[model samples]
Target: MQYINPQLDIEQLGRAFQRDGRLLIRDFFEPAVVEALSRAVDEIDWALTYRDVNGDRVLSGEQLRSLSAEQRAMLVDGINLVASQEFQFSFCTDSLVAAAKRGESHLLARFMRWMADEEFLASIRRITGVTDINRVYAQATMYTRGNFLVVHDDHVDAENRRLAYVINLTRNWRADWGGLLHFTGPQGDVLESYFPHFNSLSLFRVPQQHFVSYVPPFAQGERTAITGWLIAA
Candidate 1:
């Protein structure tokens, strides 16, 4: 499953990403896979209201601090529990690792095969130059909609987390339609942006400040993507 595709010309992509801390490979996903993912997301319940730190709906309040004491308790509990939202999808960061750690191999085994498949993983390795990934240290991504992740560096505590990878599942996305990911340089300077268009797979270094802009309400539809950390062993 870890075999390399000789025709991919990975060294060039690897060098570019190393120099700039980011790389975008256009048309990385096959049309059929993209369509299947798009349909999967469409089946989820979409939400305009989101629960905040307080148990109340953030969309219904003027500020997060405005919630009552009872609401605040609900918010605290929810913080530890992640639920699917119409606009975002996030899973427990350690789900895959925990399964592997307990000697349960099915989830991770399926994932390893998925990553190595030409329809999936080969292109990623060609661009990322990652080798001998540690199965116990990785996790699955929560693929959801309009999830605008704010600017921040990747987890500072994950020792092996050197890069972030995103496989675009968005179709017909446009620059003006928004949901653009902004990458900042080491000095807090704006580096570049990539729109969530079809077949766009992006990889970037971990320490960079990056944020995703909100998907405009007027856009034809919400955007989606599969994201995971590429860690060192």
Candidate 2:
């Protein structure tokens, strides 16, 4: 969020997204309209979370206890077991679902509004050349030591996701510290990768094979980003 008032050449970005099918725009996406919400990010209540077999969830201790033993075991042990090979993730998150429902006076609500603003959406349309984009969903994600996401293609019927985006906010991250975003090829070869560079915007077409590399225990700082999708709606 460094550039508060700098001009961005949307047409040029659009060309890049067109030619590459994915792009990493350095120091982009700092919307002055959402400056207040960006400032309030430190106050967010983070959920120490993992994606359960059921779906996206954030469980409290009492809530975890309330679940049946079988369910809880599957969500925790079973899912972790899957992580040994298959797709799974563990990280801190604060999905802005509830905040998006509030009035615009709320900082997060205003941020959500800004995301769906015609001016902003227009920029996205120009980039991807997918004019159907109507709205988007966003969540704050933080990867601390040991946090990881195994490879998976983002897809869900009726969601109509056009592309996925991640805006990194962390500073001074080292390359060897891990937590890089990696895209895979058909035979599981790494086609491309991007470190969680501070103040950068990453985008790729939806339903693409991608994963966040595991953060090693020796990682010096948190890997933080605002990630979400631009949807066709």
Candidate 3:
């Protein structure tokens, strides 16, 4: 992605989301934080993968398949991972969940609140036109490197979630290296192809048909991001 702007005002980003039901905000995170996250990604293990719909083993340095019985249990119990396609990636980490459950702060918990900060949520609500969003339903939190999210929409009839907010954490990404978030409008037109750039935010209305392409990465590099939804509070 080319350098367009270095700043993203909350008000402008919020309005964009409200009008289009989706918006991409570039440079949404502080530069230092972005650098810290990139370093952190290097420290985390993201070597896990799963077979995509095409029966191909989807590999990523930012995501991995659940390894332990506890991890799988977390996915099924609505505490750790949330269901997407046929798998669940990490949202908040185990330590984070443990801390919150024990009334303490975890790294993952801090990240979640940062993404849902006042200005950020305002931008999301404006984009999604979601009223009383505090009624936020389910939030699927996780990190991914090259793991692909199969083409689909958020649960429409599932009475809780209403929107999907995908925030990019990787820096210096390219189109051919894969990890692009593609969206299809109701009319069947490809509406958006958001590149994976550091500190960028992509907010879309619930149930809009979309898919993450399986394009290979640049020599096994990572395309990291955190994804989840806002449900009724």
**lDDT-sorted candidate list, best first:** 2, 3, 1
lDDT of 1 by residue, 68-172 (tens): 889756754563254333222222122344444466645343444455345444455556665533322334332233344556777667476766777666666
* Lowest lDDT 10-residue stretch of candidate 2: 33-42
* Top candidate when judged by lDDT against the true structure: 2
* Cα lDDT tens digits for candidate 3, 197-232: 777778777767887765442435656665667776
lDDT of 3 at 121: 59
Give me the displacement of residue 37 in model 2, in angstroms.
5.4
Q: Which candidate is the best by TM-score?
A: 2
Of candidates 2 and 1, the better by lDDT: 2
lDDT of 1 at 31: 62
Flag clash pairs in model 2.
none
Task: Give all candidates' CA lDDT scores.
Answer: 0.55, 0.77, 0.57
Quote the positional error of residue 18 for candidate 2 in Å.
0.9
